[model samples]
Target: MTKLAHHLGCFLREHLPHERGASANTCDTYAYAFQLLICFAAKRMHTQPSLLEIDQVDAPLILAFLDHLENVRRCSPRTRNARLAAIKSFFRYLEYHDVSCLDQARRIQSYR
Candidate 1:
């Protein structure tokens, strides 16, 4: 399994801020979405978020995360959509850095 920290760090530190020129609110929202995703993934995988892999964030898992956001966390559809957007953005960033993730990124892009 590929380590998640490096890719996520790069996306958050460089890609979003420098490349995407995301605003402070956008960054915060994306960060919040990821924070929830990582925590949910850790619980589902029975491991720490730091040990998660890119493959673990597949469409099925992301779908479940979105469900959890709405059902368990009581988030609105708009918030759920926003979170998915953040995930999609992150996956798009990953595709340029990791070709192996191309299919995965495409799947995510087609999910919604």
Candidate 2:
């Protein structure tokens, strides 16, 4: 699997639950947010979600995904912010595992 796929699997299966002690409902919500994000990034990049790389999921793509959630999906601001929070959390988890994407993660976190 690609780095994104591997890290994502670990993040959802291991970090979010065992390390962070997140509830099942919270894990499910975060998974759903990533599902949407992966699909959005895949479609935008003209590639399968499994083929996506961590570097491809940078600040610009994340910003576009947030915009898509608001305009195209018609999600409420609350939902949008929740999705953003989930993304930020995942990126925070990713910081230690993938140092190359550290800057990207920070940009996402500082998006406001």
Candidate 3:
């Protein structure tokens, strides 16, 4: 189980700024979306966000989170899609560092 903290740090600090060249607003938005995801996952798993494993963030959970973003949080479809894009980006990063999650990453990328 790869540590969410380390990978997240690399994504935010190195990947987003350097590799992707994301703007400040995009980075902030992605950060917020991930913050929500961590909270949601931690609550569901009865564990701390720092301890969350890659395997814990499976497709079913992601689908549920997206639904929650729309139905519960009242986010617009555009907002939901943007959040999904951020998640997909993170999963893509996981593809290289954590091949164990390649199928999961592909599944997320192919999500409608």
For model 2, how does the per-residue alpha-carbon lDDT over 1-112 read when each residue is reduced to its tens digit? 2358989999999999999999999999999999999999999999999999988888999999999999999999999999999999989988888888778888889977
lDDT of each: 0.91, 0.92, 0.91
TM-score between model 2 and native: 0.95
Off by over 4 Å in 2: none
Which residue segments of model 3 deviate by more than 4 Å? none
**Which ten residues in a row are the worst by lDDT in model 2?**
1-10
Question: What value of lDDT does candidate 1 attain over all alpha carbons?
Answer: 0.91
The Cα error of candidate 1 at residue 4, in Å, is 1.2
Off by over 4 Å in 1: none
Pitting candidate 1 against candidate 2, the one with the higher lDDT is 2
Candidate 3 displacement at residue 98 in angstroms: 1.5
- Candidate 3 TM-score over all chains jointly: 0.95
Return the lDDT, model 3, position 19: 91
Query: What's the CA RMSD for each of the models?
Result: 0.8, 1.4, 0.9
Ranking by lDDT: 2, 3, 1
